[model samples]
Target: MAVHTLSRRQIFGYGTAGAAALMLGTGAWSTDSAFAAPVLTGNPFSLGVASGDPLPDGVVLWTRLAPDPFAEDGKGGMPATPVRVQYEVAEDERFRHVVRRGSVIATPELAHSVHPEIHGLRPDRVYFYRFRAAGHLSPTGRTRTTPAAGSDPRELTFAFASCQAWQDGYYTAYEHMAAEDLDLVVHLGDYLYEYGVKTNKRGVTTDPKFHTETVGLARYRLQYGLYKAEAPLQQAHANFPWIMTFDDHEVENNWADEISENNESPETFMLRRAAGFQALYEHAPLRRTQLPKGPDVQMYRRLSYGRLADFTMLDTRQYRDDQPCGDGASANCAERLDPDRTLLGARQRDWVLKGFSRSPARWQILGNQAPMGQTDQDPGADTLVWLDPWDGYVAERNRLLAEAGTRGVRNLVVVTGDRHQNYAWDLKRDYADPGSPTVGSEFVGTSVTSGGDGADMTPQGEQFLAANPHMRFFNSQRGYVRVRVDRDRWTSDFRVLPYVTRPGAPVSTRASVVVEDGVPGVQV
Candidate 1:
């Protein structure tokens, strides 16, 4: 693939009078007419448009010019030259009140993707945006900015979800999520599974284009293109701005730190990881600061919604120690009890601790990828636990919980997604001590389409709650979690879908619970 670098003068020229003329004129670039272009054929906006990472003064708008998204070489059917794309941010959906309009060059170096960071807008308000490239008009997306810093907002509403495997099932949950009135959507990792497509129990056939596992940059880009091409998933992206972080499956299964599950050399694995991180940046609506540097991408950051809620999104997979005492479930493993082991490297741990000590929001939320509560798979004298989760990093988990209590962080809540199961837990300072005080609460959402049509409840799921007293509720269905936070209380509804093996599945709430401001446990 060819890469074209942009000059400073060319970039400045595109952002000025040239962009304004395209937005205000009825020429070849008009949205009302279709003019033929030599470089692009058909519709260049087939991949759709999205906006994410909202801030108090601005938001990020994203789109890619892909006439044929599944091009084998991963150029997305774009030419070698950089294309100038125009974007508009309007106060209304009909473009009558256009607030900001600019143009940016989508170069081959970044897969022809454009992320225009629009600024100087009113806070705590909604805005509509769209893109125009090569005479094709993209879908209009709506986004909202947070209230100004130190300002007290009345309420905040959003949804958090994860784990959407395309071959296993359809994305029916996102269809329902698109219809809900939410301020933002938080995706807690597993955005695109790296494994090759295979037949599942539902008898669905794998797509021929994605039958091979993703290895290089081209394959990774193709995987994301395939997932984003779904209409329901595209609808969800168009409806609300999203905040996202990654888990293990984005690159490979159960990868931790520099260790791959297949035990490849560190040099070989880092190349694969670089590909994954680069594709994630190219496709997602993330800011330019998150651009990948070699094999590392800085993902953990804080976002505040005025004084109502503060979100600390974590990157649990990047700096974690390898799973202790082998990979799978085991009984009474001594390696897991190592005090020096860490999940969030020392620097990130200190960052999170300082966030807790200095936050001013009414609700301090942690958008984590894995479950923070202890979960035992077997209930016998010798308990068995999954080494991939917090059960393996007991010392770090206890240290974080103790710090939260010492700092007096009020209304601390954690929202997680990884295990394809919904759970509500009263987070204890010490899980080994039954009489320990509950320090906070955790709401773990199920998957979007992973695991393929799970039941309402399973026999094993019932045993989980019986063994762990802190676990209050459990459901093994596919859906997302809807959360609403006010000054006095916070509520979460465990939304569930009936089936995902086929299309057109209706969603319903399986359970709902609330946590008072001063209380640390869940109320049914």
Candidate 2:
């Protein structure tokens, strides 16, 4: 794994050396002991930068120029190089009248990733932005701010997606997302999977290394670099602002608070978790509000789109009870619905209810990582199989929905991901009773990749669709959903790509689910 040679013009010799030295100083260990001497050459934007968590008055921007991504041997240090990266925001395509301009230093200790939260802009307005490094201008990106508080927006269009596996396929879903008319994109976790394995090694147990994530700071930085390399993902980030939350795959599969279920001690897991959170903060274009407080990072936040919709993004992993393994025999089985079981902790639950009760927006959307529907394990099993989703926290889900009804919150929609399949269902008070009242509606998007080796749904897909009457559309395809929200109605077109293996593949509408503003559920 010799370092890629750099051309004279492309090279940043002294600058790279300085940054590498800074990195080495920050950490006790070398970045790359495995590769004798790490030659830094990859472009900073090889993994692109993105803006997210848009505010009416501003937007957060992010970028990392990893000249030597794997330099730290996983300790997350390199020589400190004071590399000045310039950024510009404009109202138009022309270079004239650039609204915003600034240069930020890319320190080697943070893997040269810059997280800049830009403010002082008009609300509900679109702006173009780009970055310059070492006399090189990266691709131009378009982003917008949310409407001012209390403003009456007639319509709000946003997209939610999750589960992007780098090796599975090309990010065609993001390409389609860029073409759509969206105000913002909500990413419900798995922004990047820790898994890295050769395609040939993928079998029943894919990624033989079992999700080789970048544990320390340097590895985390490289992981972000790998994801930014995907063109479609980069395009989507450049196209519109995003609201993001991480699912378990971002760190490790099914990792809960302190305990990892891997027999690791709480101290060991927390240290790793800290590194994961730090890397996430470093790479994402998130507001300082999202920054961690102490060892715990709170990702629960709210965003409103004028009077049209209010989006509540949650953290399902943090503050969650360990996934109930229920003994070794039923290790995969999430424990049966317990009244005391909770998904969102007591405080967050209160916050959600309070937000819903006070929301002036017509539509209240919950951007979440997992499904809200009751997924029965044995097809027609009367007993609901308690999975890691809302199903596991029955009492909590019921309370939330009941509160919505009690407070007269109309058109509650939950956008979800993580099952790696497309599903649309009418959220009900109870799945056991087919005639239960509809509490809300849900649109679950399939994975960008990572369910299987291009394998579509089979028995479980068929049975779940049949058993669950409210479930209208189900597909195991690899794609995303396009959502259009308005005062009168909200429409979701489930778009599926032919395959993710190739680039430039055309996408088709698999199904459409629409819900009138006054209606709590969908009309299919």
Candidate 3:
């Protein structure tokens, strides 16, 4: 069994309260060799730090310290070491006049991951922070708390992205996002893949040729450790406080609460599923409330951006009925159209509906795991895929949209991940009718590195778009969205980075979609 043990020398060197290092006895594992380990080797900042769910007066700071990363057991071969981590806030780039300072201890039970909800600061303020353990110092990170409640800020800029498979390509998208100078980032899902790959060389796209899977906690932790080893992804997490949600890939490709009825054993899969969920909580920087409830817990919740927007993040995978294998285009396959079956579940759906009904913000946005807008498969048949997202839950979708329409919630926008493509659509009553009326809006973002399949607009995708007017635009591209929200309008510039298979590739603007307040849909 792998063991986590701390030497007395390291304990003395690190001190009690996370101060600088003291002279220590030297051994095979030293700070110098640890930090200098190859990219794949375990490092202090191996998993990186991230902040998320930013509130007006506070934001959540997250970091996981792994002394011996590759250990099969979570122990990382180090005895339980507790290190105090101090955070600093500053208004200027130089941090000349520090605003807030405090410390939190990184404990081993939680894999040494720290989530300090730094509160009691100016709202909408920019700050800088870093961590120090022993004589070693972590990379300087940039983050800010939201403005105080009831303060009307002039403009808000943020980015949303998802679906990064480490073996697929480098995290070039993260490199661009870190330099975007945005206030926050919204991640729809698939933060890390529970799989591994074998490659010939470094600096190139690798493949898991065989679908290596994650079973126990050790496998999951190592998978996360591998992805965090990327410098660009680490920098992006260090750069901003993120708002994250989980989709299917966090566990498996399209796993629901139970197994797919015909695919696997529900009892066995649920136990594995629970392990995956716990591992995610152990590694990521999410709040206590976001923790898993049992073998499963819903992750759909709401976050607001002052009076500018209200974001409702949803979990579509955990609450839906089994998708049809070959139910075909018959009404049976359209089981999603049944009012009995649900997507958001009762409680989550109610929470979102009530939120939309009461929201006073100009824009009601949804941070969804799958596509909510209608798409075309054939004619007169606006059938949703039983295995895919909204397609698997049609009746529930209609009810949600119907509620929005009836409540007169103007400018309803949904930001989505999964499908590994970018899409802009006009949510309407019907897409197959050809005379459907626009109800709300949706801006679906493409994946970060999942086989940029649709990066180039496909003829089939284009033809589908033409047939379905509700879908204003679509692209199979690898990129993220830079959104700017003001009092009157919101502009999303689809920023595309060059192919990640190649290094230092130049980024270019693929397109831009803009939506105005009170406008139910978007235009070029």
Candidate 4:
């Protein structure tokens, strides 16, 4: 492929009416004045542009025609009719070297959102893209395709973050994340909170429109609009390609497979779940394969960065068995020992294990929602553990850890979210045995803004570290984790922000740890 240059100011005469006229194959606009479409008035790209699910030769570009994102009808301020939107991909930020150009239809049925999958591009290269519609040019977004399959890549730099509650505090962490020199961003889960906000600890006023918990499609769409409308969050999405998954809060709190936290009827809860899944699909830069089918969406998928890393993203909430021992922190009981209990359903477990057995990448990274390490809340004679995490599904955890050892995976790293604090642990084959083999390492990232202005440490944090011998480091703060992976070593920096209740919080490294290629533990 040869590089070509065009004027940055070059504007094509392509418009929605022109495209519609051409589609009719009769030049309808040129012949009939009465059939002319009305002119659009405002900027429709209020929610900004994003790209995700990047392959070696392709990437998905996303944008919504939301002139008014907070519209009560959840139509994104788009008319009832479908509209044509044009997009372009270029090798230069100035868009002077255009590589690919195409158009997609945005319909009201999907809230005028469009996800255009662009392909036929060179591998392991950075590209710039933008959307054009209604004579308005959207903010240019930068995306990069992964290296060719089975090709050896020297390095992979990425960040993983989660749990950004819009009303909790300012999105200062995302502001810093947007400035990082990273290839991709992996959002483990909790992209949006479903709970209503009346008042926050910061004394910030809540939007009345989102003052109620999101229940159906319209409310979920409104919540997404409210979050995506944030400048810092929008900047983060525009700066880099993101790989995202969902947790319970995206639909409701602590919702497992077919059971609701509030014990709502299955039929009623399924309707809410379906709406939440649909809204998530419509707002994010996901591919067609992830489209919602009723209450379920295919989320667990694999992404390869050449021979350097393989990211196996998991969906823990969708297929998980209900929390054993009646949920929350509790003492070990017989029900918790059920071998049939599962976190990842049988199919997903088989898929992940198979990937582990056959993966050729140097680093086998599990992008998961919950922490895999056993977190003992109380360490005395009466030990108490949180059942929502791996502690709840011990049998499955042991099986997966044993499988990793049996398969002889070179470097198994589990990057997780959902926990509001940062944790670095040495994953053991058996949590009950201190002498068990350390099969892998886990990095649990802190929240973006979920837990207001967190401190360096808390009493619970001290108890947690004192109780779990496998846990190496712990920090109660608001931020994300920056990771750099290479053939020889993997380094993670626990990036933290001082205060999220106020704006302009400076981000700093709270802790740094590195694991060598053959090492299964972290060196602080």
Candidate 5:
């Protein structure tokens, strides 16, 4: 807990709430610690404010001083110098009940971004935050802290979304999500893609920078500016605290560790990765401890929402062997059968398994970036599968799934991202046998706007359903998954949008699946 422990004296010193502070607080012009302002142009709060990584005591408030968003230089039109930004958090939407206030330095080293961690606040509380830099004030963001540690709460409601290609369509799904009554939003990855935008559906990327793939820090920043500056996405951020992670698109498409998809030199790919990691950290509402070190950013960590849920947000792309047999669907890929192949790597795999065994929460959520269930592209004797996800790393996936049953984990849910299609899977111990005992449930959410106005059902989805009997449901639609978790049941609604190429698309639930307590598989 840092400045969140606001004293009554500091609150009163600024004079009565909303009265004296309204006049003098407008420009705390005489503070000794305030950094010198340099006639900043436009509104520096163009990207909006966000909060994330909530704890029982605190949350991270994030913003960047980007007066000129989408500047070609990717510096958000800020100078090389750092600026002092002030933040205020209140229990109410109005600043009249302000509880915490502080200043943080937005440095050029981190692309003028600021993340001020507020701590020592009361647990299980809702707070509103905003940022002030130069003469500009940011929009207010709503955030909620987790229930007190070890306390079992009544229920938890949240949503998970992924894969919003800016060129594909608008973030209309996010607009609907922003209005939902939820506790937290988990971004499972693909926050931004790496490729250039050409013949775009939305027709907004006219900049020449959009003609080239993002390779350096500046280009990545420009890409983020294009996406994060969207009003709907920003509204989603301002609506609730987010648990964010990057999949392949944040760096490169289908990237495996330092191995680039186009087979670039390891050294070359590392530079690009470092730039991508830094850009993600700069723009996301993450803790300071999550800052990247070179090409390495440890994103696999556990967060507890009282004793109701344990969310283990994973990094599937950072520590995986390159996809075998050229990384696509193949009928007979001998390299994938190797037991050494892994998606979670060694340490992360072990860490997740251990946490599962000892976790006290009722539901153990693997906030994965890709599918964990086996999806056979072709049925019959010879197995055909995509060599990207856990299906490509069979032994490791089996080991993790088997241990969950062995450890007697209460409720296991693998909420996954990627593949712009919805799937509710009954995860079996062995996919080769149709009768293998069901061990858990894996809910694969479709994209926010990735596949560009997908249909309700497709030929590929039909083939998958026919090939995998354990697959309970499949819908090729564009939207997110709204989930509700309680002591006895967990429900997922496959919320879909008819179209996203334009804007103002209403969402509807295509299907719903329920996983009852003590039951491992799904019930449609």
Candidate 6:
């Protein structure tokens, strides 16, 4: 295919030559092959720069050149050929103290996205990086390495967010998150919604592509292009490194493993899933190891921040059993009581158990997609719940919690996102018994923009809080959760916004909760 790239300025020129050799930065491979710099027009870095998966020694830097982000063809208005992208990391914002500089090719196969996983740097320090391509210099992004293994770090401040449906409202939450002092951002799924919208919340006409739901590679790519082009989202990604995973809407609503929510043909559904996975990997700042093999990608992993905390990110959707009784607020579902039903397939469940036993970290943080606590949806004696979450797989939840409690895992905390409502639940050894021991704590965050300017409290929210005494706090609002952790305690602030349908909404902390060391439940 002949490659072509369009720029806003419509100016076209050949790019300058880059490094003579290519280094993967992951310390994986090196080649003396001549770098080929293609002709790129205008500014290709329209999507901006981002970094993620920060390790003790290195991090992944990402950038894609798309002058025309919403091009119907889904090429980001770039030539079909690969473009050589050069990057420089400096000790300071200015290039005067440059540290690491290298080149990587942005290939059309991945929609001209570059994920350079560079290594060989000092641990637990700050660095600024930028990208160069087609005579254009991308924006500078700040990222830092985690503390060296076994080293005691003083504190870590980060934010966790999810469910940003572009058409529902503006990304005002992201703009606020970008300005906050944070070390990292953990995105627990629903990065993009698969549904179509006629217009976004910004009161602008959406491109024609937004009228149709995404079903293939091209449509998914187009969807990402539209969201990534937003300046607020881009700024958030640029401000701090992110650890990402996907939930239902990234593929389809409440989709189980190899099963579509609408029950589309198995073959057809898998193909669409493949496209979603491929597009997600192409746009995300993930390591090469997590590349999709057909419809499967190993997204769950463990990240350690010294001996203070160990984060075990879970993939709740891909490996989950289908929801019991068709996935709504079911009054009584015996199918969910099956002992063999699982949310995290056998391998993943075992991984989590083994990691818990072996990790030396004082805090066990489960970075999860959905609420792990049993939510009694009905205040009456007849229990009801939305069955897509852990509530659908009671056996797995019980077994997992049993192990944590039995083994005496200290400070077991689960930070969750998906329900669009903020909640603090005391994870009980058995939800059936109100007086059961509290094995862990679950903090479920509200959505970034979903539910469209939610209220401070809904009637249903009030009802649920009253019914479930184990649930300490509940709020229905639009915002993310900010967390600060130290050796002594864990604090979570439920940040809120009054409106997202309109722009320039101010943010405030609606509620703040803490769990002291050696505690397994929420405190005032």
Instruction: Give the per-residue Cα lDDT of candidate 3 at 477.
Output: 72
> Which is better, 2 or 4, measured by TM-score?
4
Measured by TM-score, how close is model 1 to the native structure?
0.92
Q: Which stretches of candidate 3 lie over 4 Å from their true place?
A: 1-43, 74-77, 92-96, 199-211, 260-262, 325-332, 379-386, 452-454
- TM-score, per-candidate, Cα-based: 0.92, 0.86, 0.85, 0.92, 0.93, 0.94
- The top-ranked prediction according to TM-score is 6
Candidate 4 residue-pair clash tally: 0
Summing lDDT over every window of 10 consecutive residues in candidate 6, give the lowest-scoring window. Answer: 12-21
- CA lDDT scores, all candidates in order: 0.85, 0.73, 0.70, 0.86, 0.86, 0.85
Model 6: per-residue Cα lDDT over 1-524, one tens digit each? 11224321121111222111112322234445565666666679988999999999989998887887788888988988767788999889988898899888776767788788878889998999999988889999999989999999988899999999988898999999999999899999999899887866757787667899988888898999888888999999998999998998888888898788998866667778878887888788888777666677889999889998888999998888888898887877899989999999999999999987898898899999989998887788977877888888998999999999777688899999998999988999888876789999999999999888899989988888877889999999999999999999999999999999998999999999999989889985
Which pairs of residues clash in candidate 4, taking residues 3 or more apart in a chain or in different chains?
none
TM-score of 3: 0.85
The predicted structure with the larger lDDT, 1 or 6, is 6
Candidate 5, residue 164: how far the Cα is off, in Å:
0.4
TM-score of 6: 0.94
lDDT by residue for model 2 (42-112), tens: 45566676888888898888776655444435322334554656689898866576888876666555556
Residue 337 lDDT in candidate 1? 77
In candidate 5 the C-alpha lDDT for residue 211 amounts to: 81
lDDT of 4 by residue, 1-524 (tens): 11213211111123555334323211112223222222566689999999998899989889988888888778777787766677999999998999999777666667778888888999999999999887788999999999999899999999999999987888989999999999999999899999887776557776687788899898899889988999999899998899999988999988898788999877677778888887898899988778666677899999999989999999998888999877887785666668899999999999999998999989999998989988888757556788888888989999999998898798999999999999999999988787999999999999999989999999999998888888899999999999999999999999999899989999999999888998897778
Summarize candidate 5's per-residue lDDT along 1-524 as a digit string, tens digits.
11323343332223444322222221222235556876887889899889999999989888878888789998999987757788999999988899998887676767788777888778889999998888888999999999999899989999999999999999999999999999999999999998888668785647787688899999999999988889999999999999999899999999998689988877677778888988998899988667666677889999999999999998898889989988988878888878898888899989998998888988999999889999987757767898999888888888888999898788889999999999998989988676789999999999988879899999989889888889999998899999999999999999999999999999999998999988999999
Tens digit per residue, CA lDDT, model 1, 190-266: 99999777655446665676788998888898888888889988889999999988998888989987788999877
Question: Which residue runs of candidate 5 sit more than 4 Å off their true CA positions?
Answer: 1-34
Using TM-score as the measure, name the better of candidate 1 and candidate 6.
6
